[model samples]
Target: MLGMPVTSFGWSVNLIVYLIEEFNIKSIAAAQITNIVNGCLSMLPVVAAILANSFFGNTPVISVSALISLLGIVLLTLISFFDNLRPRPCETGSILCNSPSKLQFGILCAALALVTTGSAGTRVTLASAGANQYEKRKDQGSFFNWYVLTVNIGAIISATAIVYTQDNVSWKLGFGLCAAANLISAIVFISGKRFYKHEKPMGSPFTSLLCVLVASMVKRKAVISSKEEDYHNRGIGKEAKPSVSMPSKSFRFLNRAALKTEGDKKPDVDSIKNIWSLCSVQEVEDCKSVLQLLPLSLAIIFVTTPIVTQSSFMVLQALVTDRGLGPHFKVPAASVQVISIISSCIFIIMNNWIVYPLYHKLTHKPLTPLQKVGIGHVFIVVSMAVSAVVEAKRLRTVENEDHMSVLWLFLPLVVVGIGEAFQSPANTDFFYGEFPESLRNTATSLISLVFGISFYLSTALIDLIQRTTKWLPDDINHGRVDNVYWVLVIVGVLNFGYFLACSWLYRYRNLQGDNEQDPKDIIT
Candidate 1:
C-alpha cells in the first residue's frame, strides 16, 4: 500500500507543481495543499496493516480498502469536474487575480488525500496480502511475479493513456477513468474472497507468545500431576521410604553422579520431573525456526531499495528529456513508462520461456532464488550504465543546440525494465520463500516498509539536490533536471555495487525450507 502510493505520489506531486505554475496559484499554497494530501495519503498502508492484523483479517481488509479506493477515484473525478466548470480568471483580464476560494482548493486537496489514503493504503496492501494466499513457496513466487506484472501493467496503461488524456482531452476524463478503474478493481477483489485463504487475524504476537507459554506450563503441570497419581496408585508413596519414592539404586546413583558432574547444588525434584515434560519441545523448536530467517530478511530489504528508485528518480528524469516525435507531435512525458512496461513483459516472457530453459539444458541445474537475485544485480548495474550513457548523450545534444529523438530515451527505459524484471520477481520470491508461514503477512509488510523508506530517501535526496545545487536556477529551464539524472546514475552505480557485495556475502547462507501448507486446497 505504501510503496504504490509512493510511485503515484511522485506523479501527483509533479502534477500539482505543474498545475500551480500553469494556473498561477500561489506557490506556498500549492505546496501546502500537496503536502497535506501526501501526508494523509501515506498513512493508508499503516492503517490497512493494522486493520488486517487486528480485526478485519486479510480478505475483509482488502475488500474495504478496494472500496475506499473506488471512492477516492470518484472524488478525484469530482475535483476535475469542478476545476473544469470554474470560470477561467485568465480570460477575464485578471491573470493574477484569486478566483476560486482558497477554502475550495483546500477542500479539494483534502478530498484528493482521502482518495489516496484508501487507494494507496487499502488497495495496494490487500493485493499483496491476497498473493500470499498461495499454497506453496514456489507458488508464492509465481504469484508475486504476476503481482509485480499487474502493477507494471497498471503503470504502463496509466502513463500512456492518463498522460495523453490529461494533456489533450481533459484532466477530468483522465481522473474519471482512474476512478472507474478503481471501482472495477474493487468489484474484482470482492468477488475473489471465496478464493482467498480465510485466515483470521492472529492479534498481538506478544500475547500469542504468552498464551503459548501459559498453555505449555499448564500441560506440564497436568503431566506431573498424572505421574504423581500413577506413583500413588502403585503404592510407592513418598512417606513409605526414600528408595521406594524414587527409582532403582543404580539409576539413583547415575542421576546423582550426573548432577554432581554438572554442578555442586543438588537438582530439585520438580526440575527433574519437568525435564520429562514434552510441552516445551514444540514451543522451543518453533521459536528457533522463526528466528532463523531474521538475517536473511534484513539482507533482502537492503537489496530491494535500489530497484524502487526506478519509479521515483528515473520517472522525474524522463519528464525533462526532449521527446518531440516529429515536427508537429511531441511524446507524452509520462508515456515513457510504457517503455519499461513493454521491456518488463518481454523480459518475463523470455526468462520463463527461453532463458531458463536454455540454462537448465546447458547446466542441468535449476535456478535458485539467490542465483536469480545475483543475476538481477548484474542487470541493475548494466541498466544504470545504460542510463548514464543515455544521459550523457542527452547532455551533449542539449549543449550543442541539437534535437535528440524520443527513440533514444527508449534505450535506457528498455534496459532498466529488463533489469527490473530480472530483480523484482526474484527479490519477492526470495523474501516470501525464506519466511515461516505464520509471519507471511508481517514479512511482506516489512519488505514494503523498506521500499517505502527507500522512496522517502530518494525523494529527500532529490529535494536536497534541488536546494543545494544551481540546477534549479530561475532561468535554467525551470531548474536543470539534467543534474538530477546524473545524480541518479551515481546512486544507481553505488546501489549496484552494494547489492553485489551483499550477494557475495550471502552466497553460502542457508535458506529456510518451505513448510507452509499449499494455499490452493485451503482456498478451494
Candidate 2:
C-alpha cells in the first residue's frame, strides 16, 4: 500500500502544477479537472471492491491493479519525456498558451484514468486483506491504524520528495521514479502471494442483497410472523441458521421477505418457490446491515468535503505564497501539502502508542469507533475554523505584501491531519466491523466512497461559489478566498452535528462479538 502511493500521490499531488506547466491549463480549469479525477479515483474503488469480493479476491486484485498502476505511470513518464506529448510551457502571465492536442489530451486522460482506477482498486482491498489476516478484531484495528500510518508516510514522500523532484528536477525523472516505485510495489506484492491468506470469492454477495430487497417488495402484502421457523433456511451448515433471532425492527417493512408464505418450502428443498417471494433470514439481515450503515456513510461524505477542498486549493494558495526556505532553497508549491501528511503519520503513531493505551488504562476499555469518528468530526470543525482564521490573516498580510509565508498554511492542515488520524481508521474499522461479513471488501471501500462523493461535491461547491460570488475568482488573491474557508467552517459544524446524530442512533451488530469493549464506554 505504501509503495503504491509513492507513484499514485507522486502523480496526483503535483497534478495541478503539471497541468499548469506542461499542459498549459488555467488554474481554475486545472483545479476542476483535478477534482473530477480525484472523484473518479475515489469512486472507482467501489467497483474494485466489488470485483475483489465477487470474482478475484483481494490479493489478485491488488497485484493486477498495482501492475496497471505501473503501466499508467510509465505512460505518464513517457508523456513527461516527450515534449510533443504535452503543450509547450506557458510563459509567466500568458493567458494565450497553446492547449494540448487532441491526441496528447486523450493519452493524458487515459493514463490518468488507468492510474486512478488501479490506485483506487488496491487502496481499500489491501485493508480488507490485511485485516482478514488477523482473527482478532483488536489486532485488525491495530493493523488499520498502522495501515493509515503507512499511507500517510507514502503521501509525505510523494508530496515532498516526489513533488520536489517534479518541480525542480526533470519531470521525466520524477515520473520515472514513480513508475519504478509502482513496479517495486507490484513485485513485492506478487512475491508475498504464498504467504497471503486468500479468501475465496462467494460468487456475488450483491446478488443476494438485491434478491432480498426484491423478495421483500414481492412479499409486501404478506404478514410478518414472529415464529423463528417462518424464515427460510436455504443451505446446510451454519449459514442456514439465523444470524439473529429476528430481522431488525428498525426497517420492519423488509421483514416480509423472510415471512414463510404458502408456496415457501418448510425445509427449503429443491422445490420451485418464486425467487422474488422468498429469502433466507441471513439475506434479510444482510440487507438491513447495509441499510443501517448507509446513513453514517453518507454523513461522512460531508465531513470529508472541506478537507478535500482544502488539499486541492492549498496547492494554489502555496503557488502565490512565499515558498522560499532560504535564498538558495525553495519549497515546491505542491510540497506544502506534505505538512498534513507528516502530521497524520505522527498522530496515527501517537493514537496507537499513546492515546488508545492511555484510554484503556484509565477506563479499562478502549475508544470505540464511533467515539473516534466523533472526535475526528470535532477536529475537522476545528480545522476549518483555523483555516478560516488563517485565510483571513493571509488576506490581511497579502494586502501589504505580494505573498505571505507558506508556513502559515501548516496549522490548519495539521489540525485536519490529526482529525483524519482519529476518524479515518475508525471509520474503516466501524464499517468493516459492523458490515455483514460477506461485504467485508465493500465495507473497507466505504471511505473511498466518501472521498469520491465529497470531491465531486466540492467541485460543485467550488463552481457554485464561483458562479454565485467572487470568493473564488481566477486570481483568488483579488477575491475573498477567506470567505470560502468560512463557508466550509459553517458546513463542517452542520455536518459534525449530523454525524453526532447518526452516531447516536446507530447500533452495532457484529462489533460486539469481536471486541470485548463495552458499548457504553464510548467517549462521546
lDDT of 1 by residue, 362-425 (tens): 9665466656666665665566566667666766776788655667767767876887787767
Query: How high is the CA lDDT of each candidate model?
Result: 0.53, 0.85
Top candidate when judged by lDDT against the true structure: 2
Clashes of each: 4, 0
Error of 2 at 425 (Å): 0.5
**TM-score for all models, in order of appearance:** 0.70, 0.96
RMSD of candidate 2 to the truth, in angstroms, is: 1.7
Candidate 2: C-alpha lDDT: 0.85
Model 2: ten consecutive residues of lowest lDDT: 266-275
Residue 499 miss distance in model 1 (angstroms): 3.3
